[model samples]
Target: MKKTILITGAGTGIGKDAAFALALRGHRVLATTQTEAQSDVLRIEATNRNVVLEIFKLDITLEADREAIAAYPIDVLLNNAGMGESGSLAEVDMQRVRQIFEVNLFATLALTQVALRGMIAREKGTVLFVSSIAGRVPMPFLMPYSMSKFALSAAGAGLRAEMDQLKKNIQIALIEPGAIHTGFNQAMTNSKYQWMNASSYFAHQAEAMKKKERATFKFLEARSTQGIVNQIVKAAEASRPKLRYVSPWIQGFGIRLARIFGV
Candidate 1:
């Protein structure tokens, strides 16, 4: 059956690809980007593929954006928009940490709240939260982003139990993707480099950190975005979808193995 799906952060990365792919599958797709420029690019890219993708401006930070989404009869809410910021937990800038949470955690929950109400009324809908592998395993230097995703994982689990209690046909799912070649890694490196450069005491540590970041990026460039998108679509469309969908077999398998062996 065809469904109406709304995807956030469809301007780029996995969200962008998923929006187009879902549209190709004959579902009505509403793709939201943070900026007008991105909406324009999405419009052009989607038009060529005979995909019925409509682009809208939605900065999840704004109440107006959430209201705009409420106007649509959405069947699946793909909470794919997020931001990344990195720093050591001890001396990280509080403002940057708050800003990351504003986008990644707080705003995501607010938007989900809006979607949940609509889904509850109809008693049928699916919510897909695009979390990260960092949510599952601790990683160094990205405390803010990692913590936000970890919170989302918690929210997903709690929300699933609530849905069961309410007897709502609404499904709550999570996409815990491993590293993909999104601009997120580059942005993380740049933000940390700038922050460290501006600080007197952190310059030497920042230099060493940049070397490791370079290596990380080189290793991640080989990863595929398609697998993440596939898992997301499956989460949205499957009748009996798993509560959590982790992607790129190697990373997903390795993480599960680590959990099993307590490694």
Candidate 2:
């Protein structure tokens, strides 16, 4: 069935890929970006690709932008707009942590709430949260971003159950993408260095940490987003989506194994 899907952060990476993919599949895609420039760029890209898309600016953190969701009778809401910050939680700026939460958790929920009201009244809808594998595991230095995703994953699970109990036919699912080479991983891993300095706690080992992160991503990051984008398409199109959709499978399996062994 053709569905009207609203996706946040459709400017680039997974969100952008998924938007184009969905539109090409004949779904009505409202591809929203954080800034007007991104919206314009996306519009042009859609035209260039010869796929139809409704491109618009929707910074999820803003109330006005979030309120605009109510104007569309969206069949699916894909919360993919999120920010990342890396630092030791002990010394990381509290404001930065809060900002991460604001974008990844609070704003996401706020927009979801707006979409849910319409979904509930209509008696059917789906919500997909783009979380991370890091949310399932404790990632040192990436705690700020991981912490928000953890909360988001939890919220998605709980909401799925709530919807079931209400018998509204609403579906909720989490899309946990592993290290995909979307540049997002690289930027997130390098974020800590932005605030780190000689006086910082991990200053002495900074260079080693950088090398380790670079090596880790080179080894683990998937060179393309197709694996995860496939998962997103599956979840979005399924009549009864699973509670969690993860890709690449091997990375997710490794995370599960690590969790089981308390590693």
Q: For model 2, how does the per-residue alpha-carbon lDDT over 1-263 read when each residue is reduced to its tens digit?
A: 99999999999999999999999899999999999999998888888989999999999999999998899999999999988899899899999899999999999999999999999999999999999998999899999998999999999999999999999989999999999988887898788888899989999999998999999999999999999999999999999999999999999999999999996
- Candidate 2 overall Cα lDDT vs. reference? 0.94
Q: Estimate each model's TM-score.
A: 0.94, 0.99
Put down candidate 1 lDDT per residue, 75-172, tens digits, no spaces. 89999999988877777889998898899888998999998888889888999999988888766788788888888899988888888789888888
Model 2: pairs clashing at backbone N, Cα or C within 3 Å = none
After superposition, the stretches of candidate 2 with alpha carbons farther than 4 Å from their true spots are none
Task: Report backbone clashes per prediction.
Answer: 0, 0
Q: Which number leads on TM-score? A: 2
Report how far residue 7 has shifted in candidate 1, in Å.
0.3
- Where's the lowest-lDDT run of ten residues in candidate 2? 185-194
